[model samples]
Target: MTAKVENRDFTADLNNKSSKAFQDFEREFKQQMAELYQSITSYRGVEIHSLRNGSVIVNYTVLLEVPATATANSTVQGISAELVTIVNSYLNCCQSNPACGLCFNASFTEVTSAKADSVDEDLCDGQVPEGFEDYYSPALTALGVLCVTVCDKRAASPYRCVHGTCSVERSGPRCECSERAAFWYLDGSCASRLSKLGVAVGVPVAALAVAAAAFAAFLLRARRQNLEYR
Candidate 1:
């Protein structure tokens, strides 16, 4: 991340304080990296160049390492999402210390390397985890670090949905079946049609049974009237 000092007039302070500033910077940077990987680590390399508009450009690599919980896809996405805040907090460490007052604008980029190579968008076979409920964050996908899922690449197309549309959602692939017709399972099978057919057959059979009962009652009444006349 880059931090541009807000005040341009503090050149003397810039020269005098830069050494101590960056020393503290390095400490904080290493600390954040350790928190991530649980080991003492710093950036792989850094390059500092002065800008014409009283800004210092610091280019650095995060020096990726395999995390202990590297298999957790959410953790992978988290590091990618939170690294900027980590760097910014490091730059703004002076904020917590009013005696060393300075403000900076932070900007950074993510480099996909190391353990992030295993980021599967169809993680856990596309089953949504608890609490998240059908909403997988698009952070890894947006970062371009995604190992695209089968559905994502349309490899799972020609979907099983006979009467529905299939879509690749943030939660993974989904089927939206037409409710006006028979109910469709989430997996896109029209199994509900059989149930509807059963109900349709049952209605006529029930009506015929009722009609036969009424006719038997009518015949019994006629026989009683005939006996009365006799």
Candidate 2:
């Protein structure tokens, strides 16, 4: 299915130390974020960027199946406001709870026209973007993203992580090359930063070398067998 990209921008700063607080919110509000995301109609995926000064820039991009039936301007406005509301509510919840110890001033940065389209609907819906199921938390009781990074095919390339998935736990997007890490996320998908280039190159070369060695061994065995029979 063809999809469109709609970006709603917002910025917020941490109330506590930047590093720990960011991680805490990601862990604590993960489920809330997932649920809040579902409220949007053509829910594609989200990307968040961290700045040097501790303020964060969030990019929530949706891939609409077709051109929006509603006017693009109004749709952008409505969706942007909805996102801000969702984030603010989550932050407020954090404030009330001491364990979270998180606070941030969030406000809209810009609302883009909802005209961005992609035939590759997987864009920003995570690495395996064909289905909606890959985007959210799996367990009903606990909270977490199914994939580390969701790609907006229009903006970033799909991750080909060998070991770990793309995660957004740090300053920028990187591949996570750890064991048993299923899917990677971009905006928050920082499990590891190893490139697909390495894997794409390494595996085949290793296999070819093994195959050549095996072939040489088979030839040597056949030659010995023929000599003995003669």
TM-score for all models, in order of appearance = 0.27, 0.29
> In terms of TM-score, which candidate is strongest?
2
lDDT per residue, candidate 1, 197-222, as tens digits? 65688899999999999999999999
Weakest lDDT window of 10 consecutive positions for candidate 2 = 1-10
Candidate 2 whole-model C-alpha lDDT, 0 to 1: 0.45
The clash numbers for all candidates, in the given order, read: 0, 29
Task: Indicate which candidate wins on lDDT.
Answer: 1
What is the Cα-based TM-score of model 2? 0.29
Q: What lDDT tens digits, residue by residue, belong to model 2 across residues 38-156? A: 86765655433332233334333444332432244455556766665665554443534445433434443344545533233333344443444343221111231123333322223
Candidate 2 stretches greater than 4 Å from native: 1-30, 49-52, 55-77, 89-91, 96-98, 106-114, 118-230
Cα error, residue 107 of model 2, in Å, equals 4.0
